[model samples]
Target: MTRSTVDKALQDDPFGNQAEVKYKKLGCGFAGLQGIYYNGTICFHRRKVIYGMPPNCTTLVKPRRTKGSRSPSWEELQVKLGNLKELVESARSIISGDMLAVPIVDLSSRIEVAKEVSACSYEARTSWGREIGWVYGSMSEDILTGQRIHAAGWKSAALNTNPPAFLGSAPTGGPTSLTQYKRWATGLFEILMSRNNPILLSICKRLQFRQCLAYLVLDVWPLRAPFELCYSLLGPYRLLANHSFLPKLAPGGTTKGCSGSSHPPPGSSHSSPCYLKTVGLSETVFEVTRKDKSSCDGNGSTDEADKGRFTFDSSPVFIPPAALAILKIVAIAVGAWRVVAGAVEDKRGGPGVGEFVCCSWLVLCFWPFVTGLVGRGSYGIPWSVKLKAGLLVAAFVNFCR
Candidate 1:
């Protein structure tokens, strides 16, 4: 591993005081661990770069044929490997990134900090917690350190350079990739949901506002699927129903009572009921077919479309776009009435450019939903269940709010 340039921020060069120190090495395979000392003082040295991570970091011993012991299974070893990559990258970041006071892992990036950055490190706990809580997740402890370090006036730096200071592999293939994503989303969400989340942490520990916002963005990931899927389902429903939930104009392309007819029929023997139609509309649509021509106007039956809706074996994601399209069609249907009104009289504010723009955004948000409709294996993932739960929770939260 290449030695990184040390930062000049450190005041103590105890290691540099060589005349007062001596070096000793126990017969061990771990490199750069040779014990160091001042005038026969006891202790050691270390490296600044990461080449790779050991598979079983929980134990320093490499998987070997040990007496009276069987080795880990293939699956167990894979899990270890998965964990190793995370550790390797995180260590690399600590060695490279500005977060020395508040290091973050992941994003496949590298950073650097001056070793002497400790000059501003007022907290005495930074050097004390090597193995105190290795098993339990006291990660908030680290977060707290970052908070104090920054609050105390220390600075950190990020470095982007070639020949990365450390190297690691992420999981590949659909199953692993998705599993990893879920794991990350879950962790962030859980943190956000807890008092340990950046918001509360910031309050308790003087965390910077900017850092808190960044933390919120990251921690909010797992909550997205449900809302997105809800929008996705709207598409097909709208297409099938031939209706839209959007608020309608009063009539004749107007918000007020600019009417022509009330929703009613002609005179009967007993009495006459009547209604008005204010908006006039007409539209043309083009659809593609594979072999033959579709010789019918949309005014007829929608048996084929209905059949596709009921029988299509697609993920739920496709629902939103279909719904959005249905909404647009309904809006156009109502607005088109203005054309009829225009023929007889002049109208102005009825479903103007604003309506089109609004509909356009609905269309835009619908695209991802359309893609989700056919999403492969999406139904089988646990994320689906979690998504539904998130939606319910959101609804309840909104109701309470």
Candidate 2:
């Protein structure tokens, strides 16, 4: 494998840190009562199933070495699995259900065979990525592929272990973390827009109805960023306008009336466009999350201190948070100034406490960005980002007026 390939593989936290606890609940949860979708990395599959065999198909498995049966010749195997001899032999064993068969132990040959089989011609005119192997409509291929398997009337199980069976490194830096989330959000958004979405799959296939809803929960998460952004801005708006958009409480009953970017999912590197664009079916580039081996070791390490610290980069993802933080800070300062100036003008006139509280709450929510504004070196938000955020804050202030 190339160094870049190894690095990419190392960075993939397929199951994530809390996957054990999370998947355990998923297994027992009502949505998973029938079956559950899981990451492709830590799962096994039936050979026939991967070879486009539907669950309803019935087939008898023959012994690997049955009486009067001659071993298939290379010519026949090649016809079935293309010209790749190694892949053909591998497929033969899998097809015979011979789990005890010894595996190819030669690392160099294994790599060579892997490359050959992965070549485009290996699956020419075949239903490999589309219908047989890992379905490839979305960036999040694992979930989509599993959804198709379940829709084909297959069920999945989640098995947990005492010490856990698998472990992988997660992104430790804020930029890498946000980039990973952006890629995921983009992929889910793509699934949501596709015909193979859980809702459609459930209606047209064997996927359970409740499972569809569960999938919807994740697929719709990225779309909520706008609503959340609007909600957060409300606090600052209220502070600036001295007006509460929320419904007022009355002693008798209550007054009814309450309602709710360069618009990227939070943490999109600055200058990057929105991930939910529907212009065309262009493939979205995947950003590998940065991982560290030292973080995985359970030893009482000193690096734990830095693990929790927020790290900054030139990515636009920090722009929203920084801008929001700046707006909140400005709102609080203005609110305080108004209160003080009003108090001086009259004995007891000032902006209401509720407005200040709301603005303060928003500040708390984005406290990290506020601190980053003044943080030193790489620990701080880049000046270019800060300048952009300041412009965004200024624009928001003008719009409020």
Candidate 3:
């Protein structure tokens, strides 16, 4: 479809704020389905599939049928199966090729939802003061009940509550005060964060890393409190904004509570900031700078040299204690596995067999190299080195023979 058509379709959908759509013609004649998330919204869309039947002139039966024919011909069944297979293949292609788009509107919706929830909670706290404790206590019960009903597809249950407060607190033996209500809210946040694993996994399955990363960077991280807690958990690379995180921020300035040094200082006249700092999984703080703009000399005067400077600092970004622990365990396990594998290979024979095994291993181990060379330009390695290694191995094997 043309871009205009796709854009129109997205605009019509409630969730299509920042949607991206991709089109592909399936090699097999199957109908297709595309899953899309518009504008950072939680709602998902599956595109409808359309299929064409064989021409009407095609005959289903032979001209001369036996008087007592008990069974249908296998050819008809085969044709039906073929059509079904084609549809399945089309769906698979659309999903596997990552052809779905996320519209901007949906993202805006999610932001609105989060903000509304925060606003509601703030207003409740401000008005009732100590009575907010009981309010939350009652709301928690209603929320849990609503969740149960919602899970069962009773849509009305979701609307039963005036403001739709979830089960978040319980009445205390003594009079519940604002302090107690705040504590309950804090506890509820923790529960949500802990339960967010399933949501994260769903995002990973959909390969929506950008959205998943954004949700974690914003909703998940901010709940930890003390503002610094979020950065400390993210580690050094925290300066570099995540793929998902950047889109959620207000267009120009640095994101609130984010650790990175803002590029071009806050009030510069340039259109956008040059860089953002973020911590990586490695705890290293890296400055992610935008590519320099190309300079053009209109009147043949020499263009000024681009002098943007970037520095990669050695300070470790903050990481959540849990994430750090997991990384350490994974690193230790991988190291141990490599040591064991190497020892086993060494004991099996000498370096000669090992070398041959390694060559075969390379083919399987680095399939990306072959695929990259085929799909892209080159593997980014010297051909001479590869050739020399091959020849050296061939010569050694010949000597052994």
Model 1: per-residue Cα lDDT over 1-401, one tens digit each: 12212322212221121111111121111122211101111211121201122212232224445574333333333333233343434433333332353345554443222222223442134322332111112222323333233332223323223544433223212233223333334344445555556677567654456656644544554555455444433432332233333345545664221111111101110010001100113221111212111235688743333111111122232222233434444444544554445521213223343344454455444333333334445322234533553464344334422
Cα distance off (Å), candidate 1, residue 344? 25
lDDT of each: 0.32, 0.63, 0.26
Model 3 earns a TM-score of 0.17
Model 3 spans > 4 angstroms off: 1-34, 37-292, 296-401
lDDT of 3 at 45: 24
Task: Give candidates' CA RMSD values in order.
Answer: 24.9, 7.2, 27.6
Error in Å for residue 81 of model 1: 27
The stretch of ten residues in a row with the least summed lDDT in candidate 1 is 269-278
**Top-TM-score structure, candidate number:** 2
TM-score of predicted structure 1 = 0.31
Lowest-scoring 10 consecutive residues by lDDT in candidate 2? 1-10
- Candidate closer to the true structure by lDDT (higher is better), 1 or 2: 2
List the candidates ranked by lDDT, beginning with the highest. Answer: 2, 1, 3
- Per-residue lDDT of model 2, residues 241-292, tens digit only: 5555544444675543222222224333421233535555444676677764
lDDT of 1 at 124: 33
Expressed as tens digits, the lDDT of each residue in 91-143 for candidate 3 is 33332333342222455546655565345343432322121111122212222
Report the error of model 3 at residue 313, Å: 6.0
